[model samples]
Target: MDSSSLIASPSLARRSKQLFLGTRLKSEQLDETMLPKRVALPIFASDALSSVAYAPDEVFIMLAVAGATAYAWSWKVALAVAVVLMAVVASYRQTVHAYPSGGGDYEVATVNLGRRAGVTVASALLVDYVLTVAVSISSGSQYAAAALPALSGHEPTVAVALVVVLAAVNLRGVRESGALFAVPTYTFMAALLGMAAVGLFRLLTGTLPQVESAELQVVPAAGFEEPLTTLGLLLLLARAFSSGCAALTGVEAISNGVPAFRKPKSRNAATTLLLLGLIAVSMMVSIIVLANQMGMRYVDPHQLDQLRTADGSALPAGYDQHTVIAQIAGALFADFPPAFYLVVSMTGVILVLAANTAFNGFPVLASILARDGLAPRALGARGDRLAFSNGIVFLAGLAIVLILAFDAETTRLIQLYIVGVFVSFTMSQLGMLRHWTGRLREVHDPRTRHRMLRSRAINAFGLALTSVVLVVILVTKFLAGAWIAILAMAIFYFLMLQVRRHYDQVAEELESDEQDSVMPTRVHAVVLVSRLHKPTLRAIAYARATRPNVLECLHVDTDTEETRELMRQWQESGQEVALRVLHSPYRELVRPVVAYTAELRAANPRGVVAVYIPEYVVGRWWEQLLHNQTALRLKARLLFRPAVMVTSVPFQLSSSHAALQRRERDLDRARPGDVRQGRPPRSFTRR
Candidate 1:
């Protein structure tokens, strides 16, 4: 048989995939996919930027538990979050320059701390990435429901669909998805900042109108009817601050994606990190301040009982409270409805695109873990589009499961957010501190030492801030949902440790030895036969061609009549190979064959036994189920015997001719990446 006939041909599924994902690119074209600064911003920073849409809402929701009086502390909380965001961004800038291989925190922790520390950081990041997708898409679904009432009561379905679409877009390739998403991300930034600017101007001119919720009175929850003491106030403020820290969820993506940037990758990534921090902080603080000044009141969506009318009466039935951005936009552009819709719509779009950051970051981190033997090797393979497609699909599946489990409720899912990210942040910053401290000892020059010391200070400050934030998040949200994230991190850590151990064991077991080079003393060949047909003849001829020391045809006697017919056909065919029959009184096929092979191996332990099984090749999938069952079982049993080699000789059926022709046609057609691979047009002329 010609080897070319075995090559798989392009099928309907392959064509459909090409149509959906676009043409495939060669590996040599990977450098062509590198992102510029403008594109990289939206690809890696969209999550941090989009956090403004919900971070402010979380802050207000946390404070609303103590009535509207607590709203005054919103700006202070926002300021603290901004300070931490800046410090983190500064710390990661040093990280990118020091280790620009796209390993980000995992690399820093592994090199400086140890493999366990690195695996810890990797687990934290993985959990956080999945949560990022779930939370962002769920929030987007909320906004979508608010904008289109028809989508109400079906947020989970909508969120799941959105996740699927995002996964498809990302599967196309990073550069293409980045380009497709750049407009929405940028428009979101412009709309939000522009609304803030307009609102500030109206405030100075004494013409800013109050939001719809301004007249509504907030009812304090139980035990908070009066003013609080210092301890109580501090605890309440800590909860609010922890919720607001969601703004810093995506700041580390730039460091994780340094390799995706163009030349001077580290410098470009560091600059993008700075831009993300500045933009995200500016938008977050602006929303918080504006909402406070405009008397924007927000509570948990499910807890509408906390709100009352201005007349001290219970609110109307089914009163929908719009999000902070929606209310602010509605008031800011009361006269022009189009501008209001633009701001609100773009907010929703950005929330969904924010998941793109996780799509980009999670796969890169998973690939790094794979290279280090902590993850499955499949996660490190590039797909047709030169993307980490296996990792992308894995992340999408996880996000979808979370969305379905939580009913796509943003508030509920938000409780599980921030814990994993902060864990990675604190560990990475601590690792950086050690990294700089060790570097300071080796540097002799005064200038270099001073620079290292400065970097060390920045990392130290970042470590302190992130560690405190992490403790606050765990304390405030443990009962809420943060423990779920912690449990997930622990599971991932243990699984990865086991995976590394398994890989190490396999490597040690596969090490070459002097005995591996020794040749077998003799070769005994056995051809499995059932029907003494064309397939059996081909297997026997191929076995004979190998010129073994001994060869025979073995058949199991299950049905007496069938066995007699096979023996008669063997005699008529007049084959050179001898025939051996094994009787099975219980009508078993696999056991009798296995017992015979074992006896042969025990007789000559120094010789190698070669078993050739004839198989039928069918084109249709259903036809495959009707054939190859016995051969498959025999091969499985024979594979376990030491010094035994199994061979499969396939006889193609008439149905397979169509597949052979299709393969030939596919080979003649030119593919998309052929030019980059320096391959000429393929032409096959029949003689």
Candidate 2:
């Protein structure tokens, strides 16, 4: 029944520890250096760019609910969403210029609207970060299936793995600088553009290969009927619009990461925003154009598998329909299958990297919010590599949970998408309009004032467009489960408000004054001694130095013999006062001692009760198991009561010395990668 045998089979424990914790990544691998614009773009903009991979798929999937005739409108919807994205991007460009402190929406809203609005914006962004992980990881898994058919049923596993990889890479160091990100980002844009180009060229040449799923027709779900009414069409369009809005999910990155760019950071960020806008628009429109051209359609495989040919013959029952990009890639790259797989694989990689955008942005925004006392202080600390590490790890953990919960089903997860992003989006745009107006009012120069006015107009338009989309997203997607995201945002908002209030109350309570520096009136020393041990002896000597009206050893007895022996010993020693023995028939020693102390305090309320307890200082971690009971519990309880000060008198045990030596030895040992490689510890850590 010893502590070591109970759970300590050394070989089994060691193996389990290695398997469960895995190998820790070295710190040197994660560089914390500043980034140039090239690296920053892919790091921060990957989410927006990676969104193209899934945004088109979501649009086509939504349109498929109403059959192929409804699919023709997909291109127009894509264009409309693109227009809004451009407007939002233009307005955020203004945001980066005016508010380059990295506060982004929270700052803009707080400055114009006040603290409540800032917290509201912060909450929305926090929830959006959760959705960003869920959406991006789910979609990434879907793409993974397309790229690697063998991994079809393993979506959640793959997505979780992807999250772990991204988290490790991010936690290693801020020095990732988007180096691994560049090719995938650029490749995704190129794949979409190339598909568009080749599709268009083949169309003009009358040689375009048909999409794989083009021959198959999507049967309408239970709701939609043939020859749909105008009202029904409008509702369907609204739903499609809501889904297409996923394209705008990553637009706020520039604002969130204004600090990450090179010199002239704001201007570089604005230009990058413009580039992001153009690239996103081009790819978004191209996918719709190509899908519309090739007669591609997608649907939630859970329903609507009842399609039959014109002759009433059903195609195979278990035929798998590829995604929008997959279908398009299959069609456009028919002459080049390698290109098809390349595009699909890269698309998947980029979608996972898209979450990396959230990874970078979430932590930074969290750190800023934490600095403002709106979040946990842990988030505020810049990690060793100078990144918001707490935020990154937090986001990664959340994404993994969501991925596992939803089984990485993009179809279901998309329902929770865009709610947070658009909430922050519309609020941020409105905040920007106020920002411009405020600037214009301060500036007397005609040109500068006019520029502010122009920016205001752009933001005003963006606010209107985004607000409309926001309303649509709420209305159309609410029943489809957008409510979950909205609820999450509300929870985050209120949680932040509560944290801020708690911090504010603590600050008010803790603020020091001149009275705090003065010494106490007198030091009363009361030592709690359960036995006449070395710890008790040390406490008695230490307490005697204080020299107060009350200097005595307090003991609680559940047994009569031990108390008599102690009393006999105390009398033999002739130490001034008799040892106080509090009775405990219930074996409740702490209560009796506490009551005695309270009785003493009632006689003298102005006096302090500084009760010192004997405690073991062990070297081996498991030594605490050998000694546990009333002492630890008594000290903890006493510390909470007002006017009562509890102190621990350390009595070192043999095990404590060994454990301390082990820790000291660890400090001198070379880290895993430091000696073998010239690079820092993090770089040498294997994937």
Identify the candidate with maximal lDDT.
1
Expressed as tens digits, the lDDT of each residue in 387-484 for candidate 2 is: 67788888888888888888888778888888888878888888888777777778999988888889899999999998999999989989888888
Query: What TM-score fits each model?
Result: 0.96, 0.88
Best by TM-score: 1
The segments of candidate 1 whose C-alpha lies over 4 angstroms from its true place after superposition are 1-8, 619-628, 654-658, 670-680, 684-687
**What count of clashes does model 1 give?**
0
Q: What is the TM-score (0 to 1) of candidate 2? A: 0.88
List the global CA lDDT of all models. 0.91, 0.78
Worst 10 residues of 2 by lDDT: 1-10
**Candidate no. 1 TM-score:** 0.96
lDDT accuracy of residue 242 in candidate 1: 98
Off by over 4 Å in 2: 1-32, 143-154, 218-231, 310-312, 404-407, 512-522, 573-578, 654-687
Any residue pairs clashing in model 1, and if so which? none
Candidate 1: lDDT of 652? 84
